[model samples]
Target: MTTAVAATATAARQGPRPRGLIWTVLRVHRPALLVWCAYVLLMVGWMLWVQHVSGARIRAELDACRRRPEGACIDVMTFSHSMNEGWIGTFIAYSSYGIAAWAGAALVGRELERGTAQLAWTQSVTPTRWLTVKLAVPAVALTAGTTVLVLVYRWFWSADEVLRGDEWYYTDPFLNRGPAILAYALCALAVGALAGLALRRSLPALAVAFGFVLWFHLYLDDHWSELWPMRTITGTVSGHDLDALPASHFWPLHLMTTGVVLTVAVAATGAAYWLLRRRTR
Candidate 1:
């Protein structure tokens, strides 16, 4: 018998077996998976293109002006900084908002609203397993994609010190520079699940999830500087330098905030599980 015929015959003889809960969740959310893949591909591709083109521009400008750019070289350098660091960093920082919205509206809320989740529960899949898969699959996808972007951003950022607009201390760049962004994203997912389970409707869940995250991020932004003890310069430093945070504190501040965010993520996830169990019980 041919290989194809043998396989078909084997399958027919074995009969159909039940698909795993994870596989079922993935199949149901295939569109979302595709969208995430596209988003990561497009974002990574764009950042690479920007790095290449901007590297060329910076080199050209450096050569033309002998490294001390006087006129047009400054503009090119500035624009390159905006593209390479400003735009890319901003996207990396704020992309969690989109994740939050989609998690609430598409992943959980709509499934519940349309009785899709309920239908799944009848198929020997416990509600707990269903909810666990729903959160786990997206969390893994988000972490993987976000890790790629963070690595590329760091690679691109290292080559981009000369073109200066965004700095490591800036909110958007700072978040992109560390695990804080990833923590924020996971927290967003958890919060979104909680919102969906609470509202049981797509649009309202989407709005509440997005708004809560927006406020949460803004709060972090305003308070992140206080997460760690700031060192003061007793020496004679001029104007803005007086208020400027010591560069050495970058890691301390970053890690402290990352811990805070991750703590919140864990708490939110706990809340989600608690809520799911309560309602289903």
Candidate 2:
């Protein structure tokens, strides 16, 4: 009876097995996770600073301009240009491309190239679950990071409209202004994963993934204006004029684009899973 009780106690102490697959995935990609977290935090911090400190300063300068009406203030102009055209825009574009490259080279391609993916499958992790984990972990992380940045960016963009910053039609601003950024990030990840699965070579996969993302963005940017129907403004004296859609109309357009991009992401992820299954079989 004593020995049986001791055995039961030991069994209770052992508890349930840990989720080794998720732990392994996270462990293998911890460095990328840390970098992504840092990037999100840095962007949020910058937007906060711009919204509170820099925005206030710009407002004050504009007020002074109204009062004095003398010369253009270099500081205000420089700050406006930087916010509209510099770091914010550049960061948004690069981050999307970076994700594609990382997904292709580090996440999927490298594993397949090095036979680690096959080894994982041999260890009882099925190909489908492995692929699912690969997609799910990054999707969640990318959504979280992009959502935070978009919310902060929207605040900053709207708060200082009088400053005449970048317009909504601009490529970077359009992408960064809403949930579309998250969609794009996910699309990039899916595309990269598919490329990696197809090529089974890290460098070539990286190149293909980055190229696809670039092409996708360029095509979208070129055709974005036509995504939604244009509302013509006609005056009795001025006749019909083709005017840009109001800011209120942007959400629908953004939603449509997001849906399209997400569909592509889903399709690519499915293709990758199918390909993996076939390869394993």
lDDT of 1 at 60: 75
- Model 1 pairs in collision: none
Query: How does each model score on lDDT?
Result: 0.84, 0.83
* Candidate 2 TM-score versus the reference: 0.87
lDDT of predicted model 1: 0.84
List pairs with backbone clashes in candidate 2. none
Q: For this target, which candidate reaches the highest TM-score against the unseen true structure? A: 1
> After best superposition, candidate 2 residue 253: deviation in angstroms?
0.7
Model 2 lDDT, full chain set: 0.83
RMSD of 1: 3.6
